[model samples]
Target: MISAPHKSSGKTLVSLGVMYNLVQEGFSVNSFKKGPDYIDPMWHRLVTGSQCRNLDPFLMGAGNCLDSFISNSDEKSFSLIEGNHGLHDGMDVDGADSSAGLAELLETPVVLVVDSQKMNRGAAAIVKGMQSMPPKACIKGVILNRLQGARQEEKQRSAIERFCGVPVLGAIPKDDALAITERQLGLTTIDETADAETIIRNVGEKIASCCDLQAIRSLFSQAPPLKTSQVKAERKAIASVSIGVFMDPAFCFYYPENLEALAKNGAELVFINALEDASLPDVDGLYLGGGFPESFLRELSGNRSLLRDVREAARSGIPLYAECGGLIYLCSAAHYEGETYPLANVFPFEMGFQNKPVGHGYLDMKSVCDSPWFAKGERIRAHEFHYSKPFDSSEIDAYQFEVLRGFGVTGKRDGVLRGNLFASFAHLHAVANPGWARRFVALASDYKVKGRCAV
Candidate 1:
């Protein structure tokens, strides 16, 4: 497990560099992300060319999360688990579901990534506290990031090793050129960055020179073997339906397992670029996942022809499902920076934003929509993080889910309903909720048979 002192401490950069280096050593690597983030896993996929599965204990429970990890893992290939935020930080005060807690559950050794910008012995104290906790966090090694000079690196490395009794595996110098850009959500996707292959190659080469590759590989080798059931096997697709997905950089927040679930349920996904595409493809249903639509408001609004096509698709009874940014894209207009940009204009409400996060957490809800995806009162668990909201609150009175454990679209409910369209801020994981993909495929099958949804 690759963990950090806190968020933005370059844990992801370390993981990326290390994984790329490992792959260059002729090792087939499988990657796992600790949280519900989409962008980081995308980078991991770009480096490894394999699906980076998500393992969220809070969402899937400790046992199930481990099972998912093992089930999705390969015993032959090297596995790297990239944790979120700090090693011991979690959703609640108790830190029950932290990355450290997850390491304990899996009995996996951890490699802590530290930013040594203004830190020295203080780093030892932090890792020592983490090591001395009642339930030890099994922090094995350290990777110092952003070290300035050779003198500073020697002192920082000596203090952390002598005081904390852990090895300092590597020290990366401060390089502004290595910095990745960010928007409202987080790092820009690998798809957006230029010369991505060369960038990843350089990262790998640097890490291979700085860090001890053999030691990192040895850490994962010591972990318990992946169970027979945990190892995935080839399965033939069983369902037959075409599903159109808004799959460009603007709508690129899908979990790898989610796509796997849809494929297992026999879905043939047609990826559509919302920014440049002028019309929806001939498909049974449409899926719009989450991304930074606000950043490209001008481009989205200018694509009037695509918007009209989407609006017509909904009217024609296409089974359309949308998440956070997708919800905003389907609305009449979005308000940002004192301007209104027209989108699909399918919904009556206008989307607006808050200066801060309007809703962010694990969402617990019960379905109230009489739709094909869920029976009335079906419970669902999903991840939610958004700053945008609907301007008209009462307009969502007929939404599909009653929010049981989150600040939904209106604090009490989410999942807007309009004929065959369902839009919301909650992002569901397909692995944790396979029923979601199954139901989606069933709906798509129905729509494919009739060329319209059955009201």
Candidate 2:
């Protein structure tokens, strides 16, 4: 496990570097992120050439987290779990759902990445505290990042090893070139960053030269064998349905498990580029995942034909599911920086961008009305992170979900329903909600059988 005292401590860069280096050395690396994130996994996938799965205990539960880790890490030469935020930071006061807790559950040895910019022996104190804290992770090694000179590195390394009683595996020098650009969401997506590969290669080379790969591999070997279920559930066969997925730079925030679940339930995924595609494809259902549609406002708004096609599909009883950015795309228009960009207009509402996050973090919602996707009174555990909200509040009561926790479309409700279309700001994961893919596939199959009848 690669973790740190806090966020922005250069652990992500270290993870990417270590993974890339190992992959280059002919080791198959399986990566997992410890939260509901789509961006970091993109970089991980780019480096390892495999899907980076998420292991969120709060959203997916501890049992699911263990099962997922065991299943995905099986038969792989190397398994790396990257922690989010601080090792002990979590929604729970007891830190039961933090990355340290996850490390303890999996019995994985953690490599602490400490930012040694303004401190010398203080880095050791932080490491010792993290090691001694309740729900203590098996912190076996430490990596001093962003060091200035040999004197600074010597001071930190000696202090950490002497006090924390852990090996100083690496002391990475401070280099701005190794950093990935941050945005309102987080790191820039691999699709939009043209030099993403170059950055990964550079960071990997730097890590290979500085870090002790042999020691890192030794720690990985110390993890105890996890007891995983050998039995795989048999999937019931269903009529295959093509589901169009918006997968371009404008819409790329899809969880890998979500797509895999859809395929397992017999749905053929057809990728669609919302920014470039002139028209919709011949698919039974359309999936629009979360992404930065706000970034390409002019281009998306200028794509008049595609917008009209999407609106037609929604009106024609075609099963359409959209999250966050997808919800924005399906709206009438978006107001940003005093400019209005026309969108699909599936629902008669306009979206407006805010300086701060309008809806962020975990969400608990109960279905108020029956929709093609979710049943009435169904409880949903999902998450939302967005800066955009509906400009017009007249459609507040038209939603399907009664928000119990976190902000939704409004402070009260979310999950706007129109015909067979369901749009929301909350993003769902298939591992947590096993019925999501099944129900979505069933909905699409029903639509396919009934044909495109106008609602």
After superposition, candidate 2 runs with Cα above 4 Å error: 231-239
- Pairs that collide, model 1: 71-230
RMSD of each: 2.3, 1.4
Candidate 1 lDDT, tens digit per residue, 1-455?
Answer: 99987888888888999899888878898899998888889889999998888889877777778777777666688888999988888776667688888888778889998888987667788777778763467888998889888888888888889999999988899887776777666788887888777877777877787888788878887886544343456485865998999988789898877777788889998999999998878898899999989878999999898899888888888888899999999889999999999889888889999999998878999998676666698888888999988888676547788899987798889888876678899998776676888888887887888875333
Model 2 lDDT tens row, 1-455: 99999999998999999999899989999999998899999999999999999999889999989888877876657999999999998888888789998998889999999999999888899999999997989999999999999999998889999998999999899999899999988899998899999999999999988999889888888998876666365574564999999999889999898998999899999999999999999999999999999899999999999999999998889999999999999989999889999999888889999999998899999999887688899999899999999878696446889999989998899898877788999998899898888888988998999898886
Candidate 2 local Cα displacement, residue 23, angstroms: 0.9
Please, what is the TM-score per model? 0.93, 0.97
Spell out the clash pairs found in candidate 2. Answer: none
Each candidate: what lDDT? 0.84, 0.91
Q: Report the Cα lDDT for residue 371, model 2.
A: 72
| Per-structure clash totals for the candidates | 1, 0
